[model samples]
Target: MDLNLRKAIKSNVSGNSADQLEATIVDAIQSGEEKMLPGLGVLFELYWQNASEADKDEVLNALEQAVK
Candidate 1:
């Protein structure tokens, strides 16, 4: 089967409001289901693509702290 996960995730969440998006993310994380990872990754990819260097640095710093 040919499946495009990023395209599928984008199509599902496109046009969502900020609160709705947040809810979706929270639900996905709280579910702790492996199936939701691709969706989260797509969301992160979207954020990374649009983020400024400063924003990227901030996220990286947060991730570094999170891993510690």
Candidate 2:
């Protein structure tokens, strides 16, 4: 993936709900395995489409701590 594009996606995640972020992360990992991480945005959008606000918050919080 292009470094600039990755940076752009990272920026899209600021203040994003946890469910949304998790879906993105999952997509990234899945795509990365296929050498298709550049397509992670689609996963993020998919998750966002179905996730509840609470689900998003929970995933986001878990992600913040996990990354630390």
Candidate 3:
């Protein structure tokens, strides 16, 4: 994926507002396929763009764990 898409995915996963993130994540989860993950990337980008350093670190840590 592109850097922007990666950043976006990271952001949505760590956003402060639960409601928007919840709906977006639910949609992605319900889709249940790699094909749908990109749509979620849009929201991810939005959240990631505004994320704090601490939040970014948390997300990166979780991602590292998931990768294992």
Candidate 4:
């Protein structure tokens, strides 16, 4: 069977409230599981899709700073 992981992750978290979403991100980060990375990437994709250009730039800047 072919499974689409991004779709699955997005669907799972689609209706989450801000607090619940924050909890999901925090849990994923703190748990440090490799499996959680895909879900985090999905969440980041969602945020990127909805973010303003300035917000996107800000996030990119922070990420660049973090990686340096």
lDDT (C-alpha, whole model) for all candidates: 0.97, 0.72, 0.75, 0.94
TM-score per model over all chains: 0.96, 0.43, 0.60, 0.92
| Per-model root-mean-square deviation over C-alphas | 0.6, 9.2, 6.7, 0.8
lDDT of 2 by residue, 30-51 (tens): 6667554655655566577799
Model 4 residue pairs with clashes: none
Q: 1-68, model 3: which lDDT tens digit per residue?
A: 44776566666466456887687689779879997768666766666889999999998999899999
Model 1, stretches more than 4 Å misplaced?
none
* Tens-digit per-residue lDDT, 1-68, candidate 1: 99988999999999999999999999999999999999999999999999999999999999999999
Residue runs of model 4 more than 4 Å from their true location after superposition:
none
lDDT of 3: 0.75
Clashes of each: 0, 3, 4, 0
Error of 3 at 52 (Å): 0.5
Where is model 3 more than 4 Å wrong at Cα? 1-21
Model 4: per-residue Cα lDDT at residue 46? 84
As for TM-score, the candidate ahead, 2 or 3, is 3
- In model 1, the clashing pairs are none
True-structure lDDT of candidate 1: 0.97
- In candidate 1 the C-alpha lDDT for residue 62 amounts to 100
The 10-residue segment with the lowest total lDDT in model 4:
7-16
Per-residue lDDT of 1-68 in model 4, one digit per residue for the tens?
A: 99999989988988889999999999999999999999999999889999999999999999999999
